[model samples]
Target: MRATLIYGAGDVRVEEVPDPELREPTDAIVRVVRSCVCGSDLWPYASRPATSEGGRIGHEFLGVVEEVGSEVSGLAAGDLVVAPFVWADNTCDFCSEGLQTSCRHGGGWGQDGVDGGQGEAVRVPQASGTLVKLPVGEDSELLPSLLTLSDVFPTGHHCAVTAGVDERTSVTVIGDGAVGLCAVLAAKRLGAERIVLMGRHAARTDLGREFGATDVVPERGEEGIAQVRDLTGGDGTHRVLECVGTKPALEMALGVIREGGAVSRVGVPQYEEGPMGVAEMFFRNITLTGGVAPARAYIEELLPDVLEGEVRPGRVFDRTVGLDEVPIGYREMADREALKVLVEP
Candidate 1:
């Protein structure tokens, strides 16, 4: 089997690796049929120190079950399934609370000997709790959209839900990355009447509009803040979905949020410091929320919409590559040549 490994900054390679086998009674081996590059993967691709021993990378995929441990249930050979970005025992208390990311026995892929999603196959721990069986066949054209349920779409939904977006609330989504675009789609699905998308890329913002952004703010800093405020009659929106995890993006969200409004950030934080001190948050009574999305919890909630073709979150994938071309796919994503890259193993 071959899997993607990161050697250092901007260096990604697909090399032969050991094939996975069930090592736990709750485990399953999935033959990866579709996988993709994630925006968060670029952080390590750009800053990881160069080293001789590369580590496995990638965290989104859908596949067919090849084998399951004796204890595994509700799944069997040939069943099509999708894996959330993180693996968890859905029966755990944290998972039962809809916070699978904090499951007592949960973990992530591409670490500590666990096979990453961007590979020929993966060894899934807590199989029955981690893998969701898909109704579609291997050849369904909906595969691309269905894949979003693993991470991106659910993340966007988290942002909207956390911020209390509703038909009565106005929304301003920061950033136009895949996750940001999905945030727009999620806001619409939740019945947000007005969605303001902040981004400069014409191609992406255009899709943002299709996804439900009623206004596009292509500026940054105070300028962007003013644009969002202007759209809301200078009062700012009721909710701000900060989909870009940069200090500047956080500042913009703070600046554009109304006095009592809330901000939900779904983007993986790229910086350590921001304006969230007493003067920034306390004075305004602003609510700050959002973290790593428990995609496992939201998959079922978003699956039916994907299957019905009501929303096309898969539009985020602008490029597709084979397992052999994964290196190229990473480069394309890092260089902004691709919005997202889908890998077909």
Candidate 2:
């Protein structure tokens, strides 16, 4: 089997690797049909310590079950499924509390000791808990969208959920990347009356509008903050979804959320120093929440919506390539030429 391997920063290659087999009773082996490149993957691809041995490097995928272990009874061969980025036992306390990302067992993916989905086939741990069965047939064109259910869609949905977005709230989503755009859709589905999306890219902003962004702020940092405030008549929005985990974007989310409002941040934090101002949070009385998304928690609830086409989270994908073309896809994404790239194996 061939998989995407990252040897170091900006160096991703398509390399042949051994196929995976079910190693645990809770495991399932999946024949990947579609996989995607995530912004989160870029972080490690850009900063993980240099390694002499390249490792698998993708986490989001939709595939067909090829085999399942003894304990995995809910799924079987021929079932089409979406694998969440995190693998958990589902019965763990954190999973029960809706924080499966922090599950006590088998947490991270797409790194050392973990087989990622960006290959011909891969083994999924805790299969019954981690994989969501899609109603679409194996030959359905829904694979692209179903793939989004694996990570970005749920992660974006988490931001909205953490911020308490609902029918009465007016939301502001910062960033227009895949996750950010998906946040716009999630906010709409959650019944937000107004959605303000801040981004500069025309294509992405257009997608944001299609997804449900009522307003688009094409500025950065302080200027973007001012625009968001102006839209809300100086009160700011009731809830803000911060999907870009950067210093400027974080500050912007803090600046644009009203004093009693909340900010749900799903972006992977890069700054070691933390938010720009802790005092503002104290004085402003804003509630801050979010981290690695607990995707499994929302899969069952969101799956139906995907099947009904109520939410087209797959709109985030801007390009599709074969596994052999993954190298160019990575470069295109890193250079900001593509929003989300899907790779089929």
Instruction: Give the per-residue Cα lDDT of candidate 1 at 173.
Output: 96
TM-scores, each model vs. reference: 0.99, 0.97
RMSD of 2: 1.3
lDDT per model vs. reference: 0.94, 0.88
Off by over 4 Å in 2: 275-279
Residues 1-345, model 2: lDDT tens digits? 898898888888898888888788988999999998999888977787888988788888889999999999789899998888888888889989998888888566665466877888888888888888888887887677788988999999999998999999999999899999989999999999799999999999999999999999999888888998899998899999999999788889888999888998999988877553557687788898988898989988888888888888988888989999988888888889999999978
Error of 1 at 307 (Å): 0.6
TM-score of 2: 0.97
> Against the correct fold, how does model 1 do in TM-score?
0.99
* Candidate 1 lowest-lDDT run of ten: 271-280
Highest lDDT scorer: 1
- For model 2 the local lDDT of residue 304 reads 83
Give lDDT tens digits, candidate 1, residues 1-345: 999999999989999999998899999999999999999999999899999999999899999999999999999999999999999999989999999999999999999889999999999999999999999899999999999988999999999999999999999999999999999999999999899999999999999999999999999999888888888889898899999898889999999998889999998888887777887789889999999999999999899999999999999999999999999999999999999999999
Which residue pairs overlap in candidate 1's backbone? none
By TM-score, who's the top model here? Answer: 1
